[model samples]
Target: MTFRTLLMASTAAALLAPAAQADVNIYSYRQPELIQPMLDAFTQETGIRTNIAFLNKGLVERLQAEGDRSPADIILTTDISRLSAAVAAGVTQPVDSAVLEENIPAAFRDPGDQWFGLTTRARIVYASKDRVDPAEVTTYEDLTDPKWQGRICTRSGTHPYNLALVAAVIHHHGEEAAKTWLEGVKANLARKPQGNDRAQVKAIWAGECDISLGNTYYMGKMLEDEEQQDWANAVNVLFPEFQNGGTHVNVSGIAMTRAAPNRDDALQLMEFLASPRAQALYAEVNHEYPVSPTTEASDLVQSWGTFTPDDVNLMDLAALRGTALRLVEEVDFDG
Candidate 1:
């Protein structure tokens, strides 16, 4: 064969040689835009291409159905319940990573290493700066006081965020106290739990309510939107605590699927997410507190002021989620 033909043949063969297999497939419950930047950074740093399937619901069932044939290497999601469910469903395998251990706190990770939290967001109170005295709402327990009747607002009680908070209440004070607290909070709502966290702030601005329950990050989101900036401006972020513990908080976390096709590449991506660089990106994009002690929260989040997060194990919150939902129904929290 001619030299030119031989060289062309060799080049074509090299180009078609299965592409070196540098990709990690992810089954994610987190929204694409919120996680895309960090995934891009991971790819840029490590050259491991990311293939993600964003699912709003049914991730666990889907993973179970795929079984051993699943192409997913990682499961990315928010809320401890989903992470814990993945483990209970036997769809995740334990990871023993020194990098993960060093970066994530024990409370933020599964004891068996089945999952790891990347960031935390506090469930806090947003009180009207113009009409409400911050002193009137110093604790989650205080929101139930008759003095605040018809003065509070919130999203549905069934939202994963509120369910986690209710679960925390159960973990701290027992099921009975949690049920009572749920009913009390319900009795005080200005309107039947009607809108999202930001909408609750808008309600406060519109004089529809004086205080509302929300995640700290929503305040940052509201501030970034011109229409919602006024709503954000009308409220002061309040870090209400448990009567005996710190503020209730939730997380966005990661897990390795049981059928990981690229174990080494998946491990690299998991460790990268736990690193300071990825933690900082989480803080920047989602306005959440970094799970790593070495990473700092964004300045805007810091400006909202800081508070002590409750030391309750997130797994406990996940464990009690069923009871929390039942209590929400018992109280007719949305009705």
Candidate 2:
């Protein structure tokens, strides 16, 4: 099965089908292009037609509204907060699969098995190769130094990616320290926190700032786009670690829906996703580190270099999300 042959459903209702269809439905926050190859491979191997309904937001609310009638079999999303939100909303069910257990690391999966991480991307620094000395930015705490004032760039502080990083700071240091650090970073902003990670890289290319915080994979993405290639080339990927910990990382993960209409097929897809073959394919396509301990990152991802991942359980960071958001607002990080 190829990308064209894979059934791409426009709505969740289209996924409702008889048992003979051998299909699985997905409610995914991930873009279709990023997962197309993995879906095509799954269809070819399992003969299970996949139907995905992509949504930018409101997935948990939609699933809650649909209740048992939801046609979605699995929920695919990035970040631990969203995954935990679905579980808290009573939209996801625990999955007990030996294949998943064997493939994904304990730190990357939910304690209750409500979600399993598929890939991880580090919250790293993107430094201007021309203007910034790599030694100047070595850890997350260094971003707050007085020397970097008016020299840093970042997305909105309240964004989930930044919140997770803030949460990790709270985990390593105390809440008060994290707030001070956030304030220092805010003071260093080249402009009001604006745009996505890629935009921050573009700013570096334009000489708007000396360094920016972003996920490692955006370098790979920028390199792939002809127009963005220059933006990517302008920066060097730097993995910043916590003061006493390793690099801060977040995940893109999956979970079975509570009302999984096609439970068997969903399980098959979930298991296949955690398998080494699929993990490798996902890593190569998305330019993220595969959660499967046995799978190595793609050649392009490896070329960016390496860092020891922080050993903190991601659920702990998810737990601190509310407080993290409050800190962002308290400091007026975007202002």
Candidate 3:
């Protein structure tokens, strides 16, 4: 069936489902399968049913269209950009919860408490084990060196993941320097920016590029896929740092919608997500680092080695997104 048909069906199902006495409705950008386990646990623990509609794009517009009558109590999404946009668009409301404040680092949540990051994934380099020396690529700036010309692979510059990384570069080094670095990396491309992070690893396996940029969690996902195991095995995950800071990171976060019909239940679910139990489930299912300092990464993710994450507040990254996108266009990085 077409994706549109499936999406409509899901939306219909969500709208038609009978509401429980205590329930929360979520409009999520996260895929259902990845989040269902946590939702189930929340329901079992709190007796609060959850109805979710997964949308790949246009979440804010949909919420805006529904206005105050929207059934959506929460918005669950990946990347700081989306969360920030939701707030900027006035589709989400500030949440005041001590549980969120205690479990999540201040850097991972908005100052106004509009959104809270549940899990984090670093934007790290994936180097071909046989072809690239790990010692040679220790930092993000190293990718721009002339020696690595025609050695890097990446997705489109406009992709939120890459933009967030570029934004961090801008955040640390200033706009002009970030632009130069972006152009240098673009010049070093093994091919025109294309495909998702995992595809870049497959490129390494095929000898298409010596290295590529990808999230830390993808390494775990690739290892679990039988057909992709060789691709995963072909590369060593490298946690590259900023020249003066730690590795760049991004998040999958949650926020309460402005028109939350079930405010009490929604707050309960939000607090539950920040709890140790949910954090552990996120690590296991999503291969992401939990936001809570007390929760450990899954063994598979832990085995990938560790590095200090750049302490740059994610809200700063969100702020520079426009400049980052403009720089990407200025350089025609994808071209």
Candidate 4:
């Protein structure tokens, strides 16, 4: 047997015993520090040894290449696109668990049970506190106005966060209208789309730009990072259009590998992760919103107040990724 096949077989046998303390292999898109606390909790609670391989890129490719030889039992990532891609690539499986079904909203999980979002993050506007009056701007379309030109800073359109934002637009407006929106956004660029969300805040702080679209958690991280706290402090977060259309929210979720050798353990981990306790920790540690229906926000996050998330179905958002990409490229967003 191939080493992967042998490894999987051994893990399968080991996990089937129920009482057997075995390792749960995870391929995580999050850095170790961000997720280790949860893993440690799991280990402490269940005595299941956790082994992780964390990487920001190429994990999907690596899993695909490893095929059945891949020892991975669980795959974790942020954003629906990667979860969707994992399903499309045949790397994940449909899992049934009452705990998961009860805890996570139907909209945040895959139609086929391929993935489950553990936490959510709003895609809110970060505006200069002293400049933009919060009430004056409430919707995404407002950014396209001529007055906002030379005032926006954002990451590249190709980033998943931007793609998901465009996808939400497509969910509301048709592809043509979505394209028009992208073009308008391109026209408003303070500079060519560059940098991560924190950098956008830095831009506003430095007077390089006055507003930008950013994931809400970046605000928390910037505030917590002593080196970057000033960037976060200088800007006020504006939750757009919760009155008409709710703010766009994205998620970080997980899935059972299609060929998982430790099916039961994988399911247990996923269920435990989706549990109110685990879900709360996932959000608290990473500055995200929990998917568990009953979970509460961390104190720092709670201070941001609450607003309705846009009702756009995340699966629908994932479906529009290709179109969003093409539209972004057509608009020469990369240039």
What would the per-residue lDDT of candidate 4 be over residues 130-249, giving only the tens digit for each residue? 888887678888878788888889999999989989888877777898889888877888898888999999999999988999999988898889999999989888888533478899
lDDT of 1: 0.89
* lDDT minimum window of 10 residues, candidate 4: 11-20
Question: Would you estimate the TM-scores of all the predictions?
Answer: 0.92, 0.96, 0.97, 0.92
- What's the lDDT for all of these models? 0.89, 0.91, 0.92, 0.84
lDDT of 2: 0.91
Q: Which candidate number would show the highest lDDT if scored against the true structure?
A: 3
In angstroms, the error of model 1 at 151 is 1.1
Q: Model 2, range 1-335, lDDT digits (tens) per residue?
A: 65533434435546666545548889889987888799899999998988777888899998999999888999999999999999898999999999999998899899999999999999999999999999888899999999998889999999999999999999999799999999999989999999999999999999899999999989889998999999999999998888799999999999999999989999999999999999999999889999998899999999999899999989999999999999999998988
Ten contiguous residues with the weakest lDDT in model 2: 4-13
Ranking by TM-score: 3, 2, 1, 4
Q: In model 3, which regions exceed 4 Å deviation?
A: 1-8, 16-18
Better candidate by TM-score, 2 or 4: 2
RMSD in Å for model 3: 1.7
Give the candidate number with the greatest TM-score.
3
- Higher-ranked by lDDT: 1 or 2: 2
